[model samples]
Structures are given as C-alpha cells and as structure tokens.
Target: MEAKEKVYLAGGMESDWHEKLKQRFHNKFLFYNPKDHQLDASEQYTLWDLHHIKKSDIVFAYLEKDNPSGYGLTLEVGYAKALNKTIILVDEKSDTNNEFKARFAIVKNSASAVFDNLEEGIKFLERFSIYVG
Candidate 1:
C-alpha cells in the first residue's frame, strides 16, 4: 500500500475551518496543526514552524481578508514555496484586489486552487492520492 501524504494546514489559528480540513483529509493525508503547540520563546516557536513546514509533503492554506491571522498564513505560504512544497490554496471570499491576486498567482498557477467551498477543496486534494491504502 502507498503511504498517505502529510499535509500541513496553514491558515488562521482560531478559525473553525481547521476541523473541516481535518475531517475531509483524514483518510488520505495526515494533517498537521502548528498552533497546537505553545513554546516559551518566540525564536524557538518560529523554528518549530519552519520544521513543521519542512516535514510536510504539501501545504493547504486558507486565506481570509481582515483576518488577523492572515500575516502568519502568508509567511507560511512563502516558507512552503521556498521549500518547494506542493501547495493548495482555499479562499472563499477573496477581495478583488490586484495585490492579493498577484501574491497568490504563482500558487494558483502551480498547485490546486479552490474558492468558495470546502467540498471543492477536498475533492481537489483527493486527486493527488493514488490509493487509499
């Protein structure tokens, strides 16, 4: 049997969508939630974040505007990109701004990109799996 891929969830920390990703990808991939850990030092935590990104085979990001967590998600996306990790971007209500479009254009061009729904995103990721077991 082929091994399941490990996907890192990069998104708003307090958002409820994390659970949805967990439920949908549970069978095909192992999802890592970086916010679950609490480290004492800021630098140490940053290192941990990078470690998690490095360990992941792919990254699934949820982007939302006016979200305080957007900055962190953006950083994670950039980090994953630098590591050459496969990325999947989900943005349901994206603003029609040039900057937002430009920033995510590369990801949209290369990896699977989904908008407006969780089911579509889940279906998109399913294509990457060669086998369930």
Candidate 2:
C-alpha cells in the first residue's frame, strides 16, 4: 500500500470542527491548534506554528464563522502556498470569492458533500507528490 499523505489541520482553534478531522485522519494528519498552548509564551507559540507548517506536506483548512478573519489559519495557508504544498479548504458555505480559493486545489462545503466525496479531495492531494519529488 502507498504511504498516507501528511496533512496539517488548520482552523479556528476554538471550534469543535477541528476535532472531527483529527478523529477521522488520526495518524495520517497533524492537528495544530495554537489554543492548546495558550499557557505557552508568545515566542514558543510562534515557533511551534512555524515548525508545524514547515513539517506538513499538505494543509486542510476549516473555515468556520467563529473566525471569519482567522489570522493564524491564513498565515498557515500562505506559508503552505510559499512552500508549494497542497491545500484543501473546508467551508460550511460554498463561497469561492476568497483569494485563497484560487490557490487551493479543492474548496468544498464542510457540512455537506465535502466529506462524502472525499476521494476527489484525496486525489487532488496526490498531485502534490509530483511536487514533493
């Protein structure tokens, strides 16, 4: 069997939605929630975020209304883009007006068909292997 891709989970740390992805992907994904390290110093938090993004091969972003302006999530998306890593965005509302949508390989509604039709998303990620090489 082929190795599962390394996926970085990016989203509003306070949202319960991220836990769903964590449970679903388990060992195949790395869940990065800065809120978990709220007690950590600012410098430590910054370093941890940078490290996680650097180590990830792909990013799965959850766009929740709780964080309409998710700075950390946006930063991770930009970093992943700079590293030429693949991105899959999950939003409850199917809005494609965002600039990041143009850059992502897949942008689907998280609440509905996105999870049901995950094969297309995974295949979109497979394309990254070519870039990884």
Candidate 3:
C-alpha cells in the first residue's frame, strides 16, 4: 500500500476552521492539527509545529486579513519554503474585486499556490493533487 500524504493545517486557532478542514480532507490525506495537541507552552507549540512542517508534504496556511500578525505561521511558512514543501496559502481577507488589499506578502510569495479563501483553496487542492479526490 502507498503511504498517505501528510498536510499540516497552520494558522489561527481562533475558530474551528482547522478542525473543519481536517474533516473535509480526512479521507484524502493525513491531516495534522496542532490545535488538537495540549501545547500549553509557546515553546512546545513552536517545536511541535516545526517538527510537523518538516514532515508534512504540504503546509496549508489560512491567514485572515483581519488577523495578519501570525509570528508562528510566518516562521513555519519560511521553514516550509526552505524545505521545499508545497505551501498552499489562503488569504481569507482578499476581496474578489480588489486583489491589492489585505495580502500577506511573505506567505503569498513563499507559497507554491495562493487562494482567496478556504473554499477556493480546497478546490485548488483537489485539482492539484490526485490524492485529494
């Protein structure tokens, strides 16, 4: 049997979006949610994130424009880029009519693919990987 591809869901844990995404992609890939772990310490969380980002095949980053200051997410994206992991960056605050506003520059540039929202990102993922179907 082939090994399942791993995708690390990164970004704000303010909502249940990560959990929902995991459920959505459960059958397609092995989804790792850092939020599920009991990472009470910032150091522990950072270490855990770094380890998984290195192991994952793809890093799916969801960054809302309103919540743009993700120190951890920024670092993870940079590391993933250096390690040659596929990065799917979703800019949740992007307006379809005005693309210039609310874009996360570093993450957007480092990403292998960028999307406006989670829904659009998921659609892109489906087409980009045969395993997603």
Model 1 lDDT per residue over 14-129, tens place: 66777777776678788778767767687887788778989998888877554543566667778888888988887643554567666656555554465545566767778877
Each prediction's TM-score against the native?
A: 0.77, 0.60, 0.84
Considering every candidate listed, which one attains the maximal TM-score?
3
What overall lDDT, based on C-alpha atoms, would model 1 receive against the true structure? 0.73
Error of 3 at 45 (Å): 0.8
TM-score leaderboard ranking: 3, 1, 2
lDDT of prediction 2: 0.57
Q: Give the range where candidate 1 is weakest over 10 consecutive residues by summed lDDT.
A: 107-116
Q: Give one digit per residue, the lDDT tens place, for model 3 in 47-129.
A: 98899999999899887666646666778889999999999988765453244444447567899998888898888766545
Predictions: Cα RMSD each: 2.8, 7.0, 3.1
Q: What would the TM-score be for candidate 1 when compared with the true structure? A: 0.77
Q: lDDT tens digits, residues 1-133, model 2?
A: 3455676767676656656655655555445655566646767877887677777766776666445555666677767777776668655323444564453323342212233233454445445444332
Candidate 2, position 1, lDDT: 36
Report the Cα lDDT for residue 9, model 2: 68
